[model samples]
Target: MFIDAIGTQHNPATDARIISLVPSITELLFDMGLGGNLVGRTAFCVHPKEQVKQVKSIGGTKQVNLEKVKKLKATHLIVNIDENPKELVEELSKLIPHIVVTHPNKPADNIDLFSLIGNIFDRKGEAARLISELQAAQTQAQLSAMELDEKKVLYFIWKEPWMTIAPETYISQSLKIANMITYPQESDIRYPEIDLETGILDQVDAVLFSSEPFLFKSEHLKEFAQTYKVPADKLHIIDGEMTSWYGSRAIQGLRYLSDFAKGL
Candidate 1:
């Protein structure tokens, strides 16, 4: 029954009381029609507003209320490897069955992860439906965007020290499918600090700043534009989840990216 190195037991038939530590996973649970089984969720999980309001908030991904989590007596605790610390996982694992899902930041790999979640929740039909929808939307977005002629774009995740989506990252792959070229396409690191002055930023047709990892507001974008002397319209602040989170919600990303491209 053990799934991986973490000693997570698989119970595809059980309708256990579940708590989700990551927002993306929480959304997945709801998407799979298992929302009724969710007893607790982190504050960061605000996808379906109704579910967010109903579930008890243990805390954010980085900081969890262990006492509250323990008291909830959840049969299954779902966590993301990148969200929680190892020590916390170990501590929680001792108290209850903890399922640690490794974050998949690549476009194709995300499909595999979703399938895995489907198996865990015993909702393969729902998962397959979502995957088909995503694939169809992705195809449509790609076809429509291609008519405009692909534009070179840079997706920024952080600003204090500029960091962008690196090559092989999910965002980068998604951008490529949307017919947008990303700068620094050779780096394998998911997120990397970029040199703005080395002709890298100059070659891009536009720059997209994410509202997470570092919330990039209009002021921040203006500052960046002024500092870089780029056009104001070229700088955009995008929803972080639409660009970063690759899960059941990714089907929504294709539509979001399609709309964003219309603006550009």
Candidate 2:
């Protein structure tokens, strides 16, 4: 028996039919050589493109098709705390035999998640290898961060409401590993909504625009340069997957952070 992030009990079975709503975990399953057992996945699980083509779509994370999931007879349903709403998880738990919910906030959290999933899928060796690789990458990222000068940055996710990553988010943790300090560190909210006129920009050395969730493009940077007093060179477009996803993708993310840190 194993407990998930939400303390849900699960009896790990070697022949469990899995349905993954978390894109990162979906990719992790494929990397673990369990892609054949993956009966269903969310449309967002685009990594391992060729493998995803064979997996059945279970709709989006929040709005999953319960009937379709039931038809597949999934023995394990994987979800994420940040991706799936509480009500949805609660509703699915009653129907699904094993609902594994994961919420990884940092590199250590990701390691634990990998171990848990490895145990669930009966692929301990593969999981260990992935964890080892991630640990090494994490160590390299931290080392590179120490060599770089401290840089204050504002990381933006959404544009319309002007959302930014707070200290509590995984992206903020990645930013710390990249030797970048996020502005307005006093916010209790994980992802806060604020405007540029709030004087937050004055404290930032740079602004990092994510290429996801809101799809911040090059044109937006030009518009921001015209509006704000910050240097145009300080604005950078970063891959959101490298900072946001917390699974096997984290190894690549940490590597990207290590390179970014050395350049700064």
Candidate 3:
């Protein structure tokens, strides 16, 4: 039996009608050759686009469609602590037989994540292959990071309030692999709103804008440059999935971060 994030011991799932609420994990499931078992997924689970389209959509991560979930008759529900809400998961647990809770705090956490999902659904060989590939990518990322200078950076996830990720987040850990240290050094909040007037610009070497959740573009950089003395060249819009997403995508994320940092 494999243990989940919530300490739930799971027996090998057979003929499992799986529903994935976590987006990245949906992709991971497909990678582990369990596409035949997936009965439902959230709207945001868009990776392996052509493959996931065949799977039914329940709803968003937080606002799940309970009626549709029940109709799907999924035996296994895959969720994440950070991406999924507790109350919704609790409600779903009443209907679904197994609630496989996952919490991958860092990039390397994919090792256990891959193993958990694969072993439970009998995809051990595929999981081992992915882990080996991820290890090679990690080495490449390390080499790339060593070539670049370590930098303190401010990563913008939201615009109106100017929200940034905390040091303890997966995004911050991914950036750390690229030799990028996220500032504000706070841990209580995952994403904290920043006040530019507080002289926060003086603390960071560069600022990054994420593409997902918020579609940050060069226009925002131009607007910010008008207000702050920081050079426009130092501000960049990054691929949010490559930095924020975990699971199988994290392999590509690590490589992407390496290339992005090298360009800076």
Best prediction by lDDT: 3
Model 3 segments beyond 4 Å from truth? none
- Indicate whether candidate 1 or candidate 2 has the larger TM-score: 2
lDDT of 2 by residue, 1-264 (tens): 777887877666899899898998899999998998899999999999998989999899889888987799878888888888889878877777887889888766888888888888898899899989998998988888778899998989998789998887888888788788887686878888977898888788788899877899999999998877677888888888898988899999999977765655
Rank list by TM-score:
3, 2, 1
lDDT of each: 0.77, 0.86, 0.91
RMSD (CA, Å), candidate 1 to true, equals 2.5
Q: Which residue pairs does candidate 1 place in steric collision?
A: none
Question: How do all models score by TM-score?
Answer: 0.88, 0.95, 0.97
**Candidate 2 wrong stretches, greater than 4 Å:** none
TM-score of 2: 0.95
Q: lDDT tens string, model 3, 66-140?
A: 899889998999999988889999999999999999988888888999899889999989989989988899889
The number of the candidate with the highest TM-score is 3
Error of 3 at 50 (Å): 1.1
RMSD to true structure for each model, in Å: 2.5, 1.4, 1.1
lDDT of 1 by residue, 104-195 (tens): 65555656666766777687888788878877887888787877767788888886688997767777777777777788777856678888
